[model samples]
Target: MTDRRRFADAVFRGARSRRSLRTPHAPLVPRRPPAPPAAPSAPEPETGLETGEPVVFDAFTADLGAGLPTGMALLVVIPVEQGGTPGFRLRAVCCCASLVEFGDVYGRPDLALGSLVAADGLLPVDVLSSMRTWSRTKKGLIRWLDARRAAHGDDLQLVIWDQTGYGIPWELFWLERAPGSGRSEGWLGGLVTVTRWLSIETAWGEVVRDYRSEHTCAGPVAAYVAAEMEHDVSLFGAYHLENSDSLHTLAKALEEGDPLAMVYVACHGTYGARLSDCVLGGVPLDRFDPRRFDRLGPAATFVFLNACHSGSLVDDAGRFRDRALRGFAEVFLRSGAAGVLATSGRVGDRQAHEMADQLFRHLRDHPGRSVAQAVRDLRAEMARMTPDDLLDVDGPEGNRRLLPLLYRFMYVFYGSPRTAVSLATGKGV
Candidate 1:
């Protein structure tokens, strides 16, 4: 109409001068977010577990979370391994200077192991000193024991403690005195350097080194519970000692076993709830059959009780005495026994040969540490240390120095899971 109103006001002034020259003058600062890279301190393996012992065994692989081995059980005093060696190599079995001279592991009876102390003595020397009882002849314990003398047979017949050239040794015990000066060692450092344990031994070197690295309760939880309790062992029967042998051949080897044959008992441990019916006359017990040739109720599966007070319980005083010792590990995991490794009192002899040579060298190099990942890596390395006095099963000093050695002594169980994974990490299962 006048050139269309001057071309629509020159297109609105050329689009507002091209948006005011793209609107920028002197004020615009907003762009942050990029600061999170500072967690690389790196120093937590102090020979704890990457397969420990300064690593170098070869063949048994299992890089870390390890796996393989569906069966297990191993107790040691020393038997470092030889004969095609694929894995398993740890041996300390007390020599770091043995201590506990309470003496006489029974056989003399009527409670005299120093007359249950208290003559003004709170010292078992702060306990947990050398712990590794028995295992010297091919690492003794039993079950096919030697297997026609290894050298190559895929060896199976349990119990080994044949130490080669002995390197880790010390102590003989008689130190009837000595308990001062920053605690030097004796009476387990006079009961772990008391002052009420110097602020928990000065924070146990930063919570066993760096507040227990991440979790799975890490650190060789003793080598992932010694390779899941020594992977894949298959014993049939013959484990009676002087009741004149013959639990009917263990029930004819639990009735020609192998519907998954897993059970090992070195013998004697006690405490109760149910499965204590005279102790290890054992197995789906209510009576006895041992399988007279075979029957295995929940399929019979795994069980191992290297004896010595099978995880000690019972302290008497009525009203289900702490529910009969916490229902003795839930009636052996509800009697079908898929896992059990007892021993809270009377365990030393070199801590059962350093816990059966680091549990068959961590299951010959972590063959996936089976049978419930070897007691949950020994109950998470016994619930992260802090014992030096272990076995209080419920206290009163575990019922005055462990209730009659775990109520009538009897041992062995492996399998019947539901609770495990503690080697030293206290606070109660």
Candidate 2:
């Protein structure tokens, strides 16, 4: 066996032994009452679109395996009190098996992870390297996941259900190099299909909806691009908004127009504590109410915020807030978006546009691939591309190499992992 295999074996053995000796902890009790049953699943009446069978969004239960789809595993990270001190409890559950690790205390490193990701103009590779090293040390949590990933292979979909407000970027966790595999090391997001979820109350209060059943890639698309990005208008075809500054108009349409399949925005995003302060395409995010999305019906409206800090959530002190603030991504999800693809840090304009192009092309080419899987594949694809492959080598200095490497890790997806887009033609609509 290789050294990596040996290490994994040791870790697995240790985990099993630890579990055997300790009593399994009780399930976490929900602070609020269980959410109401979701609207009954029904077929699309007008469009004759093949709306997949409806699946009710069940209330959050202590049983992680309850309602979990086959071939998908959930890694739930909850902040809990351990021995009168604050710590995190991690549970990895799938159809075949379940693993639980507790007493993983939070530290400065945990808090700093978010800061490093949200920082301006840092090399993404360096931040990813730091995350990888940190993952190695968390033998109880990350190592367990590594062992599970190795055992389960690449087909498993890892859904990170993180309740910890530490701003832990779970997707960036680096798994050790596979045994005997010549491929270089990769982060968790690149290696497997990953999606994220928060509590129902936190995401959309009293709004119980399953994005998988409601959302598909084959539908009308709405886009909000900046004036400078006019050249990229061909990306969305006829769906691109003519006036880039009309984000408010787009928001109104999303609220009142026909159920759109996807909402794509390519512009500048500023992160701030208040909703009014956080701006997307020069329009404060506060203008796009979650209720407006709630009115769009059950069609899975996936939003792609292709801008810097569009996916970030921070506080006045610039640290990851423990509370779930209604940020850009959250508002959409809460308002009933099937899923969201956003960036966690500052991204180069050219790189962001390229990432957007590659993403849409991938979804269009692969009709039935889930958004989560597409993101995973994209991350892997980007990781394999060299600086020369992605950029003009002689064009610029500074971040020529770093931007390509960094941008891949910046994307953070929020929503159902099973949500997919099906474009019969080149247009997103």
What is the C-alpha lDDT profile of model 2 across 225-291, one tens digit per residue? 7776665677766453333356776777676655667778877666555556567776765565344
Worst 10 residues of 1 by lDDT: 192-201
lDDT of 1 by residue, 326-375 (tens): 22322333333334454433333323434544554554466534433443
Q: Report model 1's TM-score to 2 decimal places.
A: 0.23
Instruction: List where candidate 2 sits over 4 angstroms from the true fold.
Output: 1-61, 80-87, 108-125, 178-185, 200-208, 211-214, 238-245, 287-290, 294-296, 314-322, 386-400, 424-429
TM-score of every candidate: 0.23, 0.73
Compared with the true structure, model 2 gives a TM-score of 0.73
Judged by whole-model lDDT over C-alpha atoms, candidate 1 comes out at 0.25
Candidate 2 weakest ten by summed lDDT:
17-26
